[model samples]
Target: MNQQWRLDDGQQTLVLAARSGRLPECVYWGAPLPVTEDLVALHAAYALDVTGGMLDENPDLSLCPQSARSFPGQPGLVLRCTDEIRMLYGLCFVDAQQNGPDLRLSYRDAAAGIDLTFSFTTDPQTHVITCQTTLNTDRPVQVDWLAAPVLPAPQLSDEMIDVSGRWCGEFQLIRTPWSAGLRMREARTGRSGHEHFPGLIVPNRGTTNCQGEAYAFHYGWSGGHRMLAEELPDGRRQVQFGHATNTQAAGTQFQTAPLYITYSNTGLNGCAVAFQRHVRDRIVTDAHPVRPVHYNCWEAVYFDHKLPELQDIATRAAALGAERFVLDDGWFGLRDDDTSSLGDWTVDARKYPHGLTPLIDHIHSLGMSFGLWFEPEMVNESSALYRAHPDWVLGPMDQIRGRQQLVLNMASADVRDYLYDRIAAILSAYDIGYIKWDHNRLLPAPDAAQTHGTYALLDRLRADFPQVEIETCASGGGRIDFGILKHTQRVWLSDSNDALERLRIQHDAALFLPASVTGSHVGPRHCHTSGRTIDISMRAWVAAQRHMGFEMDPRELTDHEAKVLTDVTAWWKANRDWMMRADILRLDSADPAVIAEQQLAQCGSRFVVFAGKAATSAQIQPRPMRLTGLDPAATYCINVINRDHTPGLSRGNPALKSGPLTLSGAYLMHHGVTLPWHFPETMWVLEGTRK
Candidate 1:
């Protein structure tokens, strides 16, 4: 006997079936289909045969629910009972219940005294489903492996797309053929390291930005995670994601992370739009009140914290329209470089004889908020805290140091209390508005306890100081996921400030993350990482679309550069609200050297589009960039926001005439505006409002 269930959120549908009293197996999970009570008939209609030639001899040789079943390959649940028994056999379904948009299925093994429950929830607006499983046992059970949200893929998906890169270059796209076998991408570095971001994109062959079918999955975890894409021998593909758990006692019950999945027939862009909408609506509700333009004093005057020098720099920053000024990395204890004084949180008496009050007061007077950088989870051996409690550090007594610092044993209650108190004291003493939370190293092993402790620490801080905003920075672009987003308002996408390289990183990072949550800063003319000198106009244009900031010193800018900064900041402030609340769209272009993106307001009354030239090509003629996500019947008036920075504006093309161009949304989206032939490292921004 077989039982089938289905869930639909108007746009998409998910179907599951159970055979011979076991957990439910995914039958059909894609676009909506007709409802019917006859699941057997539906299976036959799709011609899905689980039984092989020798069905009678090998009764267990059928495709079963890989989610929580006693299957031979990649068992979802690996259990060891108190009696030294390692197998969980003889499991049978108990009951199933549905409440609104949530479905819960329960299963039990009476002999083993184990109970398992799987939950499925659908967000009615985004159509993104979240799935998770929990296991509870009366007897002590040792759990080795557990998977969540095991998604079944259609047979047509043959290509997989994901991101992998190192420190300076993150989110580099990698594509490969999805063949018959298990392929897994994991991040076990105790952090979501710079490599292997926790998102997966699987689309059919030849899928482009705006066409073809695509599927996406993103794990809402910041610790060790694994994403699996497997194709069984029966031409059935499955995508599974969950937290990486080792041999741990299942005290009473254990629950996995919520794995999110979505499907789109309109291409990878549609899939990405779904994730953005889900995050904006469901994940982050209380967004930062003001996305202020920021300026950091790291690259400008590193470790040289003089009150008069910084005050002068702060004056220049305020003159350039910077609303926030961050003092980075040299204000605490006997710290001049990265080698010493990490754990100590007090202000260096020698640098600031009167504490930080004078500098903080000066910054406030300039109409800019003050932000300080701190690496709270790490301690240097030369610090006072390490000498007091050497046991607070993880690893051996003679530990191997990482970046001249040791990881604080956050799992320890004593350590958590000490760090919390230290941070709280700073918040109490000063008028700080923001904190650049930095994590410089990875944990030594797989320790979920540390991850939990970190979350607890941040949660406590948020509760205590509800007005302070936090930005998560793990080395750089190392700790980014929905898990960390719950606490922090923004993330440092990368340490490399090269505008050209940042174009690719920012473009791909925006696939799942919104532009407002990604921090993009303008660096020096000669970037530290890439050693490439980019024009200030180009760098400012790229940073305008994100949470705008500046890493370089404003005192070093020339007259032209200062004018560009003023213009860019003015444009960003005027358009940030729509950018924060708009639907993101990535336009497909035939030229690989060109990359275009647009943010369309929900009401279709306004939009902003950016087109960048990554490299110069031999072709002299430029491409006509078609726009998307507009009111088809409404007329729009378009104007260039950065008209002065756009080269060759005098050589107007046929599509764009003199004066402000006006056209119907339908005509503009179908027959786009033709761009002028621009050189490499040039970008243009177009602002359109309904007329």
Candidate 2:
């Protein structure tokens, strides 16, 4: 006899409960309670009693955990049918609604005819919360697993950071610990797999990344996901994400990807500024609201194409400021590398016999903007669209071909209408705008309809090129998520262009990416995948920390590496429109060879720290570099914006290289920012403001 529900936005609060009307549970998520709290005495004080061999009825770890009620763990629905195995017992509750800030809910089972629902919403300007689940059955069945609406793990989290990596090391933050049963993590190599990167975070237990308490999830599916967390043997804990248990195929509606949770009491950079402002203001879209300065030419002339050597490397990447160029992977078919012309999206004409319109009119006469590189779910059986569709190739035909290509069934609608008429005839024949879109390999199986046919061909080329902008390269950071950032706009986070390992994979992928959809590049002072030489000022301030670019070979730099890559690409084009709407944070480093961050500014009146030492510091002059979110009674005016990267082994006088230091944001976040004796791949760069 219970029933509760809650949902608020300003920072957090979720609630949810159920008892007699069964299946519901997320009993009290954190922070913000009291618009008159007392959700049925907070679900009977979030129940938990019957000890000694448990089960005197404590199974409501509900929200779908049911195996006819003796609930244990990992059972959020797992149906079956082709001759037995189904157990969705007594799933009660049949309605609850709201629909504005969303809140749905509805359950059924009706003697296993199924039904389930659950929606949830919340954003209040990116505090982020989104959940989902759906089932609907009646007859056909198979869904071997469903979940995406389980939530409830914080037993003061002893550890959980998840998000592993491979292929030039994508993201990489693992952590683990919180024991006593099931920790699971799956991906099944089907895009979103440079070894599982769907995302999770936990924290709580003296959390850090500048404060305490955390909790973050993110399974926005791009095929084959599985997460879990668990604990319960009565200690109660749960997590669960879905889509990878059976890869579903005999069904009557089944849904799950849209988890995206969030909750942070100012640490883990408040769930990294609410999943980077809900993915740069609500899940990317047709992009180009300023974020340019790029330049790709695949490590300069990879297949050795030469239209006057890419118009002299696009006039030295537009005299070092760039602003967009792209053209990676030998520009198409008969492609001289990565095993032949993938899916032949034309445009090669024997390496542009005057076709990519003279390199898109010399990169639009160097004012830039041109990008192009496609893989479009592979194919290359020596090309010409796998010799005219070898049965539209997907899964088996004697599988086993990743870089030699194959997977192009995108759940065929005649192969998404012949790869959307050959990628809309090269985005309607050139003057492209942008599109890196690569995927590189892995997936001889694990198809959630080939990620819904590559999100129906990137949502039909974003509704017929609403000003083209795509960018989600998989062989690098293997298909990053928020489910392909809802059809693309930057993320090629790593293919090891190694700037001291992209400054620790952009400092632990800023705990869930943000540097405006992170891409960062500036390779080739000998870093063709970690042959690590690094120094063009630590590779242009670690590619000016994200979204900035230049994948090596701007004629192999060196006029002092082309004036330090033209003064850090002119200070990332003069603070890239408020550092691409800042808030990266991550700083608490009393030197583990420092790998700082602190972008700030979203009306916190300007900031920027950087810090980066990356090796050699077990106590040796240079520490106090902390700073996060600011404003402890203001007064900043910092400076030290790269005191010419300082080295020559310390002739000490570290008032951060003498100059500008008004301090006090509680003395630079509890006395930090001293740093001066550099070496071991340095990278400082400060720049406060708010006096």
Candidate 3:
């Protein structure tokens, strides 16, 4: 018997049906239907095969399981029986149940004593569908491969978009035409490394920022994961995402990570808005308080942890309108550099003769919160902690070290308890408001159990100390995913704070993550990674768009630069709500050297537009940049926020030295306004208030 089920979230509907005592298959996954209809009749009317036929008999057919059935690419599930291998495609359908917006379908192989269940959930507000699969067996079954949320792409999806980059330069967007063969992106570093993000976007031909159909998928796992986009022989497409499960013993039940999928007809921006809302409301339920303007001591002083020098820096930071002061690295056990003393979480008596009390009190007296950095998952061979517990490390006795450190065996209960107790002790002893939780090294020979251990540790910490905020940093953006975001408040996006490079990185990351959760800091003139010296205004402008912070020493700024910082910080503080809650829009531009973005207020009362020029052009005439996401009927007063405008530099469009310029929102968005084009590597910030 064929049983059909449908889940509707008003705006979208997902239809799935079981065929003749077998596993269920997806029928339709886009748009809304006014009435529930038979999926088989719909498929037949659309000239689609209900079973996708047999792979061998019809070479062009695309099967969902693609197991020993001879379909191309990877199989969805691989099961090792007593003497032979078996796949789930041939299993008999048992039953299905739907409760509210959740659905579960079960399949069973009586002879093999294997039971497989696929669970589906939908977010009513965002219209996002999340799916996961679980396998259970009476006998021992070694499961090799499995993927969740195996989605089918629409016929019109002809292009694919994803991101890839190296350390300090993450989230570089890449778009390519859909073709035959398998496109796979895997992260095996035991963390969501910077090389590839576990998100995929498929769009129709000629998709733009604001128009065309688009579909997006994001895996919520923080550990090793893989995303595959395969184009089958018959113009059919499949998108699969799941954790990298190497092998599992028999009698052990395996559950894959949840995969989220959303669709939009209004292009990538529409997909982004849906994802941002879903993440904020479902994944991260805690209210994200206004992100403070923080001052970090890493770029300023490196490993030099002198109390008096830090006190001086905190004073200057408070004077420059910093709300929090973070002391990064070198504050613990003989840790002058990264070479020694990582797991030893005790304060260095030589650096602070008394204790952290004096420094913490000083920062509090200055009306600023205090934050500390720690890498609890790593340890150095020379450290006292490692000498006492050598078996605590994950790898072999003679394992190769990275960053002069070895990975701690988080899978062990003893190791988890010790680290948790140490961190809990610090939280209990001091008035610490924040923790910069960092992971500097990758886990060697990672297992699924280790990831569960890490999650349990974080869950215990958050439950014990809910007041203290934790920022996840894995050598700059190596562990950015919805799984980690559920526990941490924010993430360190990258180590490179070069303003020009950060513009691209932040833009691409904002596609799936909100700006409030992305940590952007203004670094020194010479960036540590890129070594590019950008103007202070440009640096402050780029960082202000996200969770704003500063990583450089205030003592290094000139008088003019100090004023600029003060003004920028004040402006950001006043407008923090808009940056935190506004809908993001990436504006289209004809010039390659220009990058523009707009943040439209949810209330429809205000908006902010950022236009930056990377290099100067030889053309004297400036082009009028068209703005987006504004009410056409409303009138608005557009004012330049940054006061660093150069007048009379360009020949055609002269700078306006006047008060607020008034114009209708329709005119400003359609006809647009021209900006100064003479100076290279500069940015302009414009604020619009509906009048």
Candidate 4:
């Protein structure tokens, strides 16, 4: 069997140190130890479920981490670790049997070992799986796991990854891991700490362009979490999973593994690797459940709506029990809607009399949180800021177009300080809790030519404000990624508001992002983009299950629809905890139809099932629907709440029973029950023992 995957000559020739079952036995080094490696000296670790042949649970893994150590004048430098470490990597294909193939890797000190034992399918197709390590270990460990096999190429530029082409690069580090911090730092002039954590350190040819060849995702589980370092096709070297995006060099999706060691006494270090092999027009995160439902005024006001009108909407929304009231675009600058009022930070006097103070005060009075929208990175020809600082705009200084809108030079220190000041000033004026920071356009110059320092400005805001929650939005879903999620609390998933369109889009989004970080809203039936009227109940129910909000004019909702909205909001308030901490199980369907089910396990026993938009069926039998992360022996009371009408069933059936029924078969073959019916429904409260 060929274990080598996409290996080049350099990697093929790379020698792995030999390991014998019995090590050089010494007083300090032997087969076993009375004293385990200190957890403080570890970087990451993984537990393998050898009994179940899956990573079903890992409670015994360990790591040893210490302060970063760096030696000067070294290329491809490898750090010598005094502490021992262990990492476990496992994979169980959804289609494979419960006793199928599970791959586990244990890395200790500097040696790495792999344990591949499982039932390989008859078909020969390799599936790549990865986990990113969290970098915040108690002690520091320096390493880059996602080492993309370097191709014979020129230096990597923002352009090669700017569009659709293959990419290859390497990450090298020569330092004491504990001496450095979490983020990977890069240098344009010096070579020191260039390939540190979260930064792509590739073999350079002393030029700015690459040879158009690169490997994608390689990572390790570190800091009690998984981390991946890969140079994506979109000109962004994403570290971990936080800011995962393929947009036009606007920003990056940054992420690493979870932090917090599983057990207090294991000494091991591990990292994760991930790859999005398929090519898609855009890259988005998964649909997180229980995203705060929001109320924004963009389509309704468009810079013309009066403060009273805005106040009325916010008050009514609060009365209906909305979590947040977002004052959309036009609230800042002379601009309104996509054109006129950008870059200008002043609140329009005619529209907002007495500034935003009255509006914010009114929102606060209603016992709700207030969110204001701002697009500080864009400029209109008529705006005061653009006139005052023409050089601040990104386009050719002399270039002029009929519709003159300019991009702010976010790379410049002056621009960042100025924008930060404007944002801080307004936020201070009102006791604001959230900001819906919007960027309506892509980078006018794909290469990020602007002089306004993007990462620095953003990092400054996070460090400075600390309290404000920023929701990153770029024209809709263009800018969703991990890098932004680190500092911002929420992100608008996409501009495509159609519920039918959202099902697939959200499914794709959730693969990389947790449900808590995404913004999935329940908009009006008549979408602003598609001009189609969908059932409000269906939309609300689906959106409500995820981090949600409303986008339409509330006044337009019928009395009956309004009640549904109010009722659903109440339910969300009551049941938020279950949606937040529980592990999610999503069922798959292959019929080019819409059938989605999310099972949330609470307290590790009780579970909630949200089955949305399925085709009508007398009996809905999901294949191998084994519940995840449950205690096999503890019995649970299973309840099914049917939100839609299926022929033979009613809402909240107390007699439904299943698992504690052992999880046998492939993940797909795991224990799943048959529902009597389906379609635009939500069947929940299914519980059982993990037998």
Candidate 5:
């Protein structure tokens, strides 16, 4: 029997080895190893030496660490029989198969009647390696934990960056230096909580946005998840990701969500590019190749959905170049506010006496496609559906509610069928092309079944209405992940339309998400969530940076604001073709006050830079912002596209502010761009065309 195997894409390689039929362990994972290298010798060298206070020999630390084997740190599996006999081990490898760039290995615990399988596949294009594990038993078992195949972290790393955020502020990066103990993060809010996003990045000691080495991992699960970054007392490190402990109920079989990992040779942006490409080009299917400009009326109308008012909003949104108008949250039942009539999916007669047809038709007549919002997985106790089937609510009968609503029992076949029927009926009756599928509240508890059932429903919907697009929004940005994104086309980045706050959130989120699926909107003049007003030009340009949209009431815009918005919308439309396909690269800024990014076209012919002055710089002069991912030998023409936004502060002329300058890409990337000084909350937009 073969004792060693390995899989390699062009950029990276993963080598696994096993002895005496024990479960295989990954001995090497990083930049590509030579094809002719000796796997056996490499595996031997990778083994750690047992020292004083440790066992006579080192434990394998196999893909599934075993408790019975006396492995230190967190064991990969936690199980029980009936109510006792918690320990189960002695698994033997039973099968192995290597095909192309994919590998599958199987193992079994005979006495326990348990079969475990680990699978891996590397995408040659995006260079992302996806891994998953499955556990099946002949009889019922209570499994508290089952991690995806564990991988070792580099010892040279000094710190780790994990994602953390809240309601209005999502995708904030927190960095913690490496230590000798374990670092654990668990999202137990049922939905992937706004507080803990399932991602981590470990950079080499001297890594930056454009240099050195980096490794990234994203647990692509929408339900609760737990991440373990542990450095054992022996100095060995490993990363484990799985559903939050005990999220699974007793079952005969269980499997984990796919764990996506990518190693970057060119610093953090390389990881960013890999994830961004894999998500947009590989995961999302049939996304209208040309992403339409969005106009959601949630902030504009809330629950006051009057026919004339909606018609007016639609006309205004269209005039400002919105191609898809999504009538948000208040068009159904008695949903006058967030609290009531959530489960009722019917069009409200009070708001639209003749039904949604009038408003939808008005939107369609204005040359924009119409979209409706639905919270299919939530129910108000005051709703007719909830009253009729109280048993359909998840958790205990006395469980607390969120946003005045209880979660629907998505695990129940009856619940899924009812939701599909209601949602499908609406699709058949209307010429709708999009659905803003909302999940405004967290579940009473974490249950993997709920996420699976939701996926099942989405799959059914996608098959039935292949052309209809769906946006997964959970209280703004709570449910954004690769798992949910597999079913939906777009993600509502955050509820806060405050440009200053958005500039930071969007910049950090660009580490994983691409510009095409991230929805950024221009909020009202007085930002509802943040309460700090931002300039119309600032709001418009920020929205234009991603999947452009407008969620504000167009009627409230002053003549100057309206013109500025219209011009920015036109600019977004002109660039959407290539911009949607661009790779968003976070630039290394010399000044911390300026948060910046460069969206480079896929063809490498052009790029645009958004340098947002988030706060007042302590230094009076702006610092040079270095760009990445450009050919050093190429020459390019650079122009400050938003030069008109320059506020007169008696500023001396900065070369970029005066006119376009033709410079070599090497000079642009190394010497960097110098923009005129700007007040806080302002942004400088630069366009570059390779000559």
Candidate 6:
């Protein structure tokens, strides 16, 4: 079961060769290698090889590669998987250099798929190995690239290792002070995937002889990677890998996870590698602990809401007990609408007057945190940035005939520096707490001149600000990919904020991301994207079960509306602890209206059930139920936070007062909780403690 892959850096282009003779290998030119059977020449088998570019003649070409040809070697690259986890593992390929470090092998675990690529460099004097696992997402993704301090000996774990399953792994070589890690992505297509590989190091983290960088994480629906760069104390620099994600599958219905390994260079001849905990089988929800429910002023202000108006919203938001207040768009430049304002990042003097300070101060005055919006990766033709840095924008430097209004080239060093400084300055100017950094566009058609430069630019920003949080948005959902999640704290589930749309969107979004990392907000119906009027109650019900929040103008809502919000948010705050710490048990949603529910177990003694009504019609009702999975003698209280136009209802009134609900398999099977025939949007938190 010795499976592996390799790469060869010759006089021509870099060549990547896979281990198996059966599986065809791919070679990436200026653009990605073609996976589909193509009508083109470079991507097809036995076509013209893209050689040259190695002497560093700009290294930019449509098809200038030496060529990475793969055929079975004398003894084929040995590959195997240690676990039957249906995970991808084993050696994928290796790249040999002329005189420098030669052997480069790639390994990946399905548990921690390839969110990052591994790089290893040697320390000159000691010959110690320094390894770093850098993310390849839209933002800076964090991954540790350190294994046990001792060298990897040729010993295998006694655990029954399986050769058929795929597993992901990372390694690195070190010289005297510098370290570089080798990351390998491998997977076996056979049926034996669950077996365990014991030779791998037991993952762990310890305070090392290294300084941590202050950087930010960014993510979206498309490509994502982590950047670990900093504008040093003295403004020098020390960059490492942030975090990265990858979608290993292809096509419309594909699959992926937040999987990657981290390596660190400890002293001695020792290095370390540990599996990161970013992968999951179901939707990741913010319903878990440590995440907060937030509110944003995008739909409310759209660019019309000035500082004072923003202050008004903030005042109410704080009163409503909102934890975070995000000032979306219009705050920057002369952005009157979505079309004209992008690319110009300066504050709109007409609206902001004394800059963003006043508004940020006002938000803090209300005892709430502040967030700002930035569409840094895009440029509008009307933007000052586009006019000033025309060469920095993507399109043919000769002619501005691209379909896009304009695109920022994040790959160039100057462009990357400009964005980093501009954003850092804005964030620093105000006591800004969060950023709704958006990319309203998708990855533009790659130009021979700027692909690597753009990628490098994004990587730099991510590594520069790891502590600040950013939300990834790509024209809503067009760019939502695992590659982007590695760097972002959370991603907007979709541009379509419709509750019904959100049900499926979030369901899909959660497939790889945790709920906390996915944003679900309640906004006005006739949603911004679809303009569909959905029940606000239904919206709340769906959004609350995840990392929940709202994005509408409170002014537009009636007093009843405000109260409904205040009530539901209160319910979230109350039972949030349960949602945070427990493994959610979702009821079968074969019926779309059944929506989603999660059972939160705080401890063996206490538990709570969070449920929502997703249907819009008043006549649709869920049947009554004798719930299962409960201690029969346990005392229970059901708290239903209803969102209909009910008169004079206050928080003190227990909507559905029931207690000590007994549980039996037959009773549970025969009865499901019944709701009002015409139930308004509502969420019920049923609480109990095991006796």
TM-score of each: 0.94, 0.41, 0.94, 0.58, 0.98, 0.57
List per-candidate RMSD values in Å: 2.6, 17.4, 2.6, 16.3, 1.2, 18.3
Q: Write the per-residue lDDT of candidate 4 for residues 147-215, one digit (tens) a residue.
A: 111111112322211111000111122221111122333211100111222222222222111111222
Across 1-691, the per-residue lDDT of candidate 3 in tens digits comes to 7667888876577877655665666767777766757677864443344355544342212213645555565677777774666534456778788999999888877876777788989888876888888888887777767788577777787779987877888998888678887888888888877877888888877777777788888888888887788887666678887777662345558888878888877778778877777776677645447788888999999999888899999999999889999999998899988899988888889998788999999999999999999898899998999999999988787767889999898889999999998889888989888889998887786466667778889889889888888888988988888888888888899888888888888877877887778889988988888878888999998988888999998899999888888899999999997778777777775566777788888788998888877777556565777777678888888877764466565444344334568787788778886665546678888888889
Q: Which stretches of candidate 3 lie over 4 Å from their true place?
A: 36-40, 46-70, 81-89, 245-251, 285-288, 617-620, 651-671
Clashes of 1: 0
- Report the lDDT tens digits of candidate 6 across residue range 536-555: 66677677767778887777
How well does model 5 score by local distance difference test? 0.90
| Model 3 residue 110 lDDT score | 84
- Local distance difference test, each candidate: 0.80, 0.83, 0.80, 0.43, 0.90, 0.44
- In terms of TM-score, which candidate is strongest? 5
Better of 5 and 6 by TM-score: 5
What value does the lDDT take at residue 298 in candidate 1?
Answer: 89
Give per-residue lDDT, candidate 3, residue 93.
78
Q: What is the lDDT, from 0 to 100, of the residue 360 in candidate 2?
A: 85
Instruction: Give per-residue lDDT, candidate 2, residue 124.
Output: 86
Give the per-residue lDDT of model 2 (tens digit) for 203-250.
Answer: 899888889989999888778888888897767788888889888788
- Predicted candidate 1, C-alpha RMSD: 2.6
lDDT of 3 at 521: 90
| lDDT accuracy of residue 364 in candidate 2 | 92
Give me the candidate number with maximum lDDT.
Answer: 5
Model 1 regions more than 4 Å off: 34-47, 50-72, 81-85, 245-250, 397-399, 648-657
Q: Residue 269 CA error for candidate 2 (Å)?
A: 0.8
